[model samples]
Target: MTGRELLRMVAAQVCVHGVMTGTRLAAPLLALQIGYSAAQVGVMLALFALSPVLLALSAGRLADKHGLRLPMHLAIGGATLGAGIAAIWPIFPVLCVSALLTGAAAATTQISMQRHVGRAAKNTSELKAVFSWMAIAPALGNFLGPLIAGVVIDHAGPEPAHEWGFRAAFAVLALMPLITLWLLRGAHEAPPEPSEEAPADRSVWDLLSVPQLRLLLLVNWMQSAAWDVHTFVVPILGHERGMSASTIGVLLGVFAAAAAAVRVVLPILSERVPEWGVVLVSTVVAACALVAYPLTPGAVSMGVCSAVLGVALGAVQPMIMSVLHQITPPNRQGEAMALRIMTLNFSSFLMPMLFGSLGAVLGVSGLFWLIGGLLVVGAPSVKGLRVDETPHERPGDPR
Candidate 1:
């Protein structure tokens, strides 16, 4: 693909992911609108995540073997349709089903894009920069999604305004995948070669022979769990603290803005900072911030904590992808990345439910504290990732 086409693809993905990030605001309120309990919301989140978990590997393999455009088109259509359905009538059960459809669409988009990024990128540094910048769209989306959704939900007046609220929000989201499908059309297809270990019988264990791959995958899973717990926990926390839906929306916006800002500069900064050091220090600090969040006096204090935590959350994806690109060859990148996504997503299902149930018993403060401790536990595992594993192109020098 030409550089222009590549950039167009990236732009399209930004829109797609931006809407995806923006839609995060929709779910909590959608739960509330439908009168689903916190536990049910957690379950819905898990079930949604599970769709991606199940499909991630196969999606990646398919992208590698075929063209990204076709699967990407399908995924975008699915997401658009799913968003449309969820907005229709907003019943509790319908929303849950919408979660499943949305999750599948999101997972497919992820795999298709990653495969394209790997294929289209000219070098390791460019790849890292692209992935890091790719994250910026989500942060911007987060800011936009909740702020807009909140206005529609809180201020929009008519009969059945809540339904109007989500319909408006989802209508915006449905537009994103079309952009992705259109942009993907311009991308040059790079079909992957059969792997050296392409035997039909290769077990997951056998396929994951690289030591770094295993470690990275596991750390990412833990990271995902902690991240998800915070996502579900934050809204519930706000409810307990008596914040309105609009206020919660603003906080989510701030958090996402912080995350986006950090990610925008990450690729440039990675050259100067150690890759593992970046991940480690940020994660540790984020954990401390999260631990303090619920204990804070009120919304303002917690908002500060959430923003700090967002800064840390922003650091994760590019750094992890950098490390992944470093160790895995291009041909295996698809499967490896797919596995990483799957593991992260599978954890997304359980962590929210686990944390929410515990919070019901222990209270929000206790839940945050527990999640904080869990983040602490995760920090060490990720912190120690060997720098020697970095790809030769962008060896993030620790010093």
Candidate 2:
């Protein structure tokens, strides 16, 4: 892919994914504003991830069969429709539906984009660089979406309730994905690999038999759980501390900005840095940050913790994607990406409710420590990871 095309892809990602990110912030805060318990909001947040768990494999197969255009169109439509529904109704049930729709759409768009970019790269260094660029999309989306939603929520209407503000935010989010369609107008879709036609008997489960992929998935899950914990718990923590919606949004936005900043330099550093080394360091740093998170006394301190955590987690995806594309078969890349999304979203779907229940008993501090402890325990396993500078697929190898 040309640099311009790559940028268009990233912009498209920001638009579609931003809609989901904004909705995630808006829905939970609205639920809380309406006097719902944190547990209830957690259930609502879980809905955002639920569709991905159920539909990721099918989405991946679609990407493999049809390439980026078809999946992108479907994803754009789903996101637009979801946000539109919530904009009109702004009810709890409709918000849940919106979450499912937007989440599934974002995940599908991500799979198609990742598969396309991975296929475009010629070597390991290029893989890392491209994915590092691609990783910026989420960070940018996360930052812009929440920052926009928060500002709109705080200022768009007479306060105490901000019902109008919430609806307005949803309407804005509903329109963001349309920009993606325009940005991708002239983008090229690469032809599918010959081996894309996998036999009907092949199962995604078979990919797990590879020990490296298995370990990578485990590490990815740990990182994903850490992310979910922060996303789900931070708003509750802020609310409990009497922080305003805009403050909480800025806090989360700061995290995303920090993440994006790290990724911006990663492409330049891709050749010099070892992917495994980056992962190991990020794992350790993320654990430390999560442990420190609940100890912060104010928004500034919490923002500091969020920035630290963002930098740690932000550096991880490019390395993971680089290793993943290298290790998985070319024809099965979409399926492999799907499998990774399924694993991460599965935890995302359940972890919020688990965090809510556990936080009520253990407190937010305990939840952070629990996840942090897991990351610490899992950090050493990164040592076992190895990536080939040039990986060749073996003929007839099931992997």
Clashes of each: 1, 0
Give per-residue CA lDDT, model 1, range 1-399, as digits (tens). 455765676566665554555455676677866677877776766666788888888777766556576677777777777777766656677666667767777777766776676666676567667677766654554455456656666555464346676777777676777777676664666655443234455445644766667778777765665567667788987887789999897787787778888887887887677668788888788789878887788888878987898888788888788777667655456677788888877676666557767877988778777777877887778755665733443111121
Query: For candidate 2, what is the TM-score?
Result: 0.86
Task: Give stretches of model 2 more than 4 Å off.
Answer: 27-41, 88-92, 147-168, 231-251, 291-304, 356-366, 389-399
Question: How does each model score on lDDT?
Answer: 0.70, 0.88
User: In model 1, what is the error at residue 349, expressed in angstroms?
Assistant: 1.4
Model 2 agreement with the true structure over 1-399: per-residue lDDT tens digits: 889989999999999999999999999988888788987887888788889999999999888778888999999999999999998998888989999999999999999999999888877788899999999998788778887888888888788338999998898999999999999897777766666567677788778877888999999999988888988889989999999999998988888788889998988876887899999999999999999999899999999999999899989999999888878777678888999999988886677668889999998789999999999999999976677656544322555
TM-score of each: 0.79, 0.86
